[model samples]
Target chain A: MLKIKVKLVDGKISKKEMVLNKKEVTVQDILDILEINRETVLIRKKNELITEEEILDNGDEIEILRVISGG
Target chain B: MDKSPKCSRCGKKAIIDIRYREEKLCRRCFLKFFEKRVHRNIEKNKMIKPGDRVAVALSGGKDSTLTLYILKEMLNKVKCELFAVTVDEGIKGYRDKAIEFAKRNTKELDLTHIIVSFKEIFGYTLNEIVEKNKVLRGARGPCTFCGVFRRRALNILSRELKASKVATGHNLDDESQTYLMNFFRGDIESSLKMNCDESISELFVKRIKPLSTTPEREIAAYALVKGIPFHMDECPYAQEGMRNVVRVHMNKIESTFAGSRENFYYFMNEIIKHLKTKEKMKFKLSSCILCGEPSSKEICKVCELLKIIRG
Candidate 1:
């Protein structure tokens, strides 16, 4: 089983150990696990933005973010 | 090996089960699950008109370039006339390359182009102004000068070209960023103005954004696929800036929220529809003190910029 650790912009960690061995997972799947909307969040795996369709691999550290909006 | 086109919405592998036409938005984006449902929403709102003379404000970026391409296609069906205008801010390194791209694309599109130079019109390029101002009042932000100057310059050129409507390259991401910025700044009036459709104002030409519903990535992809000339280089002055921070933050929100950008427009539209602004139009005009054109102040922003150059 592939275990993935997740990090939030506020430095919060996901409580669950994500097992990604069963099937292909995506950035959206991780967001689903984290219980956040796509619009309110951005994901970076290894400091690069991962679009929703980007398949996830084992041992990837995902950073989720809430973007700031305004002038 | 799979033999399907990438999803247009998400750029993922196309699953045959989804019945998508082209590109991979998955089942999610294909169903219009986006937060900023700009594509359909604009059609429902009836913002675009047939036979309109549209002068696009080109910045040689992905958004504006793709906007011109799409508008060119859309207008063909509607018999609309199209033109291009680029405001040269004279930013060394940043704008020089973009202007070249803008001019190239204008020729490719076979459209009449107008290039307004800050150096010629304002007598001081951005570099000169920033340098001069820094010696006196210290270093003001690049955006502080660029935004005011470019907007005024575009408006004047749009009028000079006798265009009824000035089209902008503002897309969903830009609009969403602006909406949130206005919300944070407590600027309800400006927010309301953004959501409002093109209306004739004495002070300025009517402004519109035909690509308001399109996503930033889609525009970039369109530009790339169509091979439309564009400047991808990051502006030298744009590093670690406040708007850059806002852009990064907006992208983050956009990734998490399926329709955050769409939601922004809806939110603004709702406010405009129901709770209209009680605040007076901040720049209501008497007349342009110099050119006798309509202006919010005695002298318009365009005239003020010209005075700085003429002095």
Candidate 2:
């Protein structure tokens, strides 16, 4: 199981600890599990912004930031 | 497992990781950085003056909310007046909520909020226009109508308000996407000439995008951290057109190559600068036949679109 902490930056939800029964997980997997739009959020692992296909290791701390489009 | 890093500046627990710069910043440091960058952008471009009355195009989205917030703070230091103008395109479910957020922000900031609607300005809402222009369908999408009318409304309102400058929340991602879209369409001249030759007509309000250097994600993070009230909802009509295609491609390119968006933005700026220096394409401005607004052609784009919608 991979243990990860996910923080929602939009303030809609509190930070939560999530565990997945996988050796490694992609950002899209987490977003899918959370039912969040892939285009709307940026996923960051540790101190680096990761793409949807970037794999996350065990005990990773991730931040999800909503993408803001201009008027 | 890698440990979460502290802010590079303050050593606080970092909330954002700026991949392009390889920097981790806490909420406070990030806000400072964001505001400072916006201030620099304004100063570098000479976008605002000490006594300039700037009109902010507030859509109550994360971008415009942060734009108004940052500009308000910066203008406070310079003793400038700011007015918030919102152009309601009359998108049913989307615009009403955004206008509420815009109203709330304007009230909190104590700035004058002017709300203009498509119905008020063009005699038809976007929905009506879209419904009427069924034959013109794919040739020009609803976004074209909305963008042209909304811009005309903002310009008209800005002049009516006697504002010196119009500030928008166009960030790096938006700039890059626009640049790429124009480039793909072989319409780079129009894109470059937009800001380069705005002084050709006094009727056109000088637009200042202070957040052009900042990325969209950073603006979102800043908005959240600063507690700026904004809705995440997008325009219901936004899913169509070349912009959406370009946006997806731009995002994909940005994700694959870090700093690509900023690089593209700077590259576009450099090209614009070069074009301005090389050939100052003087466009003869004439009054639109239908409306008295200044236009390069016989009729302004808004009026041209209105003709189709009114048919």
Candidate 3:
């Protein structure tokens, strides 16, 4: 098994040594691993919103944004 | 069930009936006082006129929908041509629900509705634009996208519908929240712009918020009374840190003071008046370089967004 680390640059949180067979994974799996709530968070892959079922390949930058409220 | 017998805002026994079946406000004192405040503000500003084509910017939210309902009823007393325009940002499940409710309410009210979609005209929804634009996250807020496009879309549609002036559902709570936010941010000029005075900039379509005198609780009650189809679930994005903090702070202040809403209006008014004297709040109007619409800069916000995304 190959090991890959997940890093959230904006929030400065890092996860190290995650095992994966392939170079790609689904967005939902990623969120599950990160323990983020999809309903409260908006994930953008390649600048477009990605549903949980969609797949993300290696080198694909992702953004996890918390929805802003108020005026 | 003996209903919850208290005012949501003050936590006192609702001495009035602000909403039927709900312990909103009492009839004798609070109701009369609140309604009279609205009437006084309307009369002082002279917001409505006979034979004027008033295009209401309805968002299917409690505020805008209630604005339409009240303005329509107000027009019965003073005859005016009232219609509604809704700009669909094409936010998939979110905006589609709003447009449906807006359309349904307009039909029920016997008012004309004009629906415009970003996809139909601009070849992209907000979803599409966000997908394409690299500078979306840190560079611009959601309002930067929604507010910019929606303003132009509403103005263009209203002009096509031959509206003399445009009306929005900006209520006192909304205005007060904005004022507090601006004051904290130290954005004096932007705060001045948020002022809902009668004579607005004439470069684009003139906009007014007649409900600026009405509280959010009152508007929500009015919407419920009219049976308007409004979405109550707050948007998912509403929990963003900075704005949510501000909202919580304002809510605390509002609860502490009975006339907090009215005070916000007067405070902003004083700021606007002072800014105007110093020429700091004087609006600069120029034709949009692309669309020839009235704008502060050579290019309008819509054109700027298009250029940024299309590039």
Candidate 4:
């Protein structure tokens, strides 16, 4: 199980915890599993930017910020 | 992510992994790189000249805010003046928050900020125009009206403020999406004329895009990293536009292929350059007969659209 927090554009935290049966999962892999477009969100761990392929250990908390700017 | 936490330059804790360069950078180094790239772009493109007044079309979004912030930072080095203008299309609950952010940023920077509304310019807010457009026999999307009106409003306000150049926060993503949108629409003329590499008129203020090479993701990251307060909510009518469709697909392609945005930019630039030389397409600029606005033809599209909306 990996802890994921979804942050909306308005800066609000939307809880979205994910539980997978696999023992090892990368950031990109989980995002892919969740069907989140990699380009549409920024992934961060411990308040620092992390790329998509970073491996996630069980109980590791991450924040995925939604990025949408259309005019 | 290879779990590298050290900045490529300083060995500090990394804040971003720039996939294009295949390098990870700390906050300080990332910001330095971002500013340097923007400054280099401005210098290389000759986008700004000494004694020139630049009016930024600030929407308070990440892209425009970063544009204004970077340009303002370059004031001492570039020998230019800067102000900001915000065009309010009067979309309820959408534009109001953005304008507030625009006002806040300008206030903080101590720069002059001007805002013009669609109601004042066209006698109709965007909401009203959309409502009226709905009952009409045949009408374009709200984006069509908003786009035309916003461009006109930006031009008028920038000119009135005695701006020598108008700067918008259109980044690489927006530019590529626009090109793809036109290409998909089968609008070859628009694609060819996208850059306006030559044949610019002296009548209207020249438009500049300093952030053309920077990706939208970088802009958003810069805003957050710098603690720059910005309005992040998208416009309500954005999802209804075809550009949104193109944007989604382009992003998907970008994800699958890192640095594809810049690649598209380089590829497209070469094509546009070759097309301009081979076709000898000199788009002569003319003033609109009714409104005296700069147009490619006798009457501007804004005026033509206004006629339909006012009827």
Candidate 5:
């Protein structure tokens, strides 16, 4: 099992720990697991900003931020 | 990646790492930096004057919400008053929620909030327009109708509110995308002449973009950090294919090249400045025959689109 910490920046969710059955997961997979819209949020891991294709490792701390686009 | 980086200003744990500048910033420092940059943009451009009533084109999105919040803080030092004008395009699920957020934000800030709807002004909601145009003319996508009408609505509302300047939340990304989109479409003239300076037409409000220099990501982060409530829902008709392609390409380039976005922005500004000096690009404005608003063409885009919808 992989232990990862996820923090939601939009105040929708509190910082929590997610135990994953896989050792690695893509950012989209995490969004799917959390039921967050892909286009609505950006993912960041540690000090680096991440894209949907970025892979996460065990014990990683990820931050999901809601993005606003021009109307 | 450095798991823990110190803020460049102070040794506090940094919340964000700005790779473009090779600096890390904590939440407090980041907010300070953001506000300072916004103030600099406004001051350098002379966007607002003392005793000027500035109307913020608030859409209840993160960018517009942050624009209103920062402008309110910055304008407090001056004698200007801030008001929010929200346009309800009559988007069923999306706009309804956003207007609610806009109302809440404006009420909390103690600013006068005005809501204008397409149904009241144009005699048809966006949905109705789309529905009618689909059968009549297979109307150009919803964005085409929405953008033209929304702009006119904002201008009219600003005038009615007696606002001297209208501020929008367009950030660096939006501007850059638009610039590139026009470039790609071979419509360099539109990009060059687009909002380079305030309009002389009395019907058009002097528009300002306080967040023009800020990136959309930074605006989003600031909105979240400041606890500003904004609806994150995107418009259902926002799938403008070419613009989206340009946006993604620009984001990819910016990610790889760091300051590429700002470089493009500055490059475009220089070109616009050079063009402005080379020739006087002026349009003789005429009142729209139908609505009596300022228009370069005889009928104006709003009247033209309305004709299509009503027919």
Candidate 6:
């Protein structure tokens, strides 16, 4: 199991910890597991921006920054 | 088997794969690609020119911050005077934090920053207006009020400052969503003004969106990569807007259909060319009797909203 800390950096700053059973998980997989829209956010790990296909390691501290401003 | 894509330009580890452009770019190459695209958009659209005084609508968000930073880079090439205008709608915790970010960016760039508030202009903060408006059920969402007032506030200040253009941080996602929303709502007539290079009215300043061709996620990524400080905190009242519904759907459509957003924009842009030539499509612009601001009706939306809030 992989221990991942997901941070949502938007109007409300909140964190969700996920313990995944998969041996390999991409950022897209994390977004899928978290049910986050890939179009509306940029994912980051270790303060570096990452792409959707970037694989996640155990104990990854991931930040999701919402890019949507309004309607 | 390493499935990771490398930079198509330099063969370095790619930070992003722009599927729409069929290019995988590293951090260094991506920045160049982004700025070059933005510069090209501004030039192709004739959004800016030498000796132009531009007022940037800086909300301290990722989009606006990227717009400001990019325009700041154009000081030499474009030879334009730039200033930042931030609308403080008085959302307490939310807007206050954003204003600090706005101030910091302007200070760092040595640019003028002006903050206009709902309290000062309308005698009631957005929070206060929402509180008072609670008496009437389904009166309106905070966005309706904020959008009308903020646009008015930005317009009034930009014109007063003698700016040639008001540069907003509206990225491709926003424009594409708007294009789709208007289409879905059958409000094509309202968007007819979009293709007009001419100022609709002297009272209404020309608005330029250099980032309108760029996607929102890419802007956020650029900001993050460049270490640009921005307050990405969502406005608490944001979810109440109708655009929230469309944005979700638009994002879904774009993700499923890569390049769909840009295609929508281009299609809409071309459609407007044919539509604008129709006699029935033209709307005459006139000044609001009460405030002497440009309006199609006797009263502008700002004054009308103020009347309701004041009452």
Best-performing candidate as measured by lDDT: 6
**DockQ computed for model 4 against the true two-chain complex using alpha carbons:** 0.46
Model 4, residue pairs in steric clash: A53-B1, A54-B1
Question: Of the candidates numbered 1 and 4, which has the greater DockQ value?
Answer: 4
Candidates 2 and 5, the one with greater lDDT:
5
Every candidate's chain B TM-score: 0.79, 0.94, 0.83, 0.94, 0.94, 0.95
Cα lDDT of model 3 by residue, B79-191, tens digit: 88999988888887777878878988899899989888888767888877766764544466555676678787887788778788799988776677778777888877567
For model 6, residues B102-151, the per-residue Cα lDDT tens digits are 99999999999988888887789999989877765547789889988888
1 versus 5: better DockQ goes to: 5
What is the lDDT for A30 in model 2? Answer: 90
Ranking by DockQ: 6, 4, 2, 5, 1, 3
Cα lDDT tens digits, model 2, B1-311, are 43445788987766666767878787778878887888888888888778989999999888888888888777657888888999998888889989999999999989899999989988888888888787556368888888888889999999999999889988887788888888888886567655653575778888888888988877776766666778886677777767887777666676567778788888788878777665554454678878889787888887787777766
Off by over 4 Å in 1: A1-71, B1-12, B15-42, B198-200, B277-284, B288-311
Best by TM-score: 6
Docking class of 1: incorrect
Worst 10 residues of 2 chain B by lDDT: B276-285
Q: Per-residue CA lDDT of candidate 5, range B1-311, in tens? A: 63355788897766665657777687888888988899999999988889999999999988889889888887658888899999999989889989899999999999999999998888889998888978896638888888889999999999999999989999988888888888878876677556657475777788899998998878877776677888886678776546766766676676567888898998998887777776565444678888889887789889888777777
Better of 2 and 4 by DockQ: 4
lDDT of 4 by residue, A1-71 (tens): 45544443334567666777786777888778767777777777887677676677777777877775331
Model with the higher TM-score, candidate 4 or 6: 6
Q: What is the C-alpha lDDT of each candidate?
A: 0.65, 0.78, 0.66, 0.82, 0.80, 0.85
* 10 residues in a row with least lDDT, candidate 4 chain B: B193-202
Question: Residue B138 error for model 4, in Å?
Answer: 3.0
Interface DockQ of each model: 0.08, 0.20, 0.04, 0.46, 0.18, 0.54
DockQ, 0 to 1 scale, candidate 6: 0.54
The candidate that achieves the highest DockQ relative to the unseen native structure: 6
Cα deviation of B154, candidate 5, in Å: 0.7
True contacts kept of each: 0.06, 0.09, 0.07, 0.41, 0.09, 0.61
The Cα error of candidate 2 at residue B48, in Å, is: 0.7
* Candidate 6, pairs of clashing residues: A11-B234
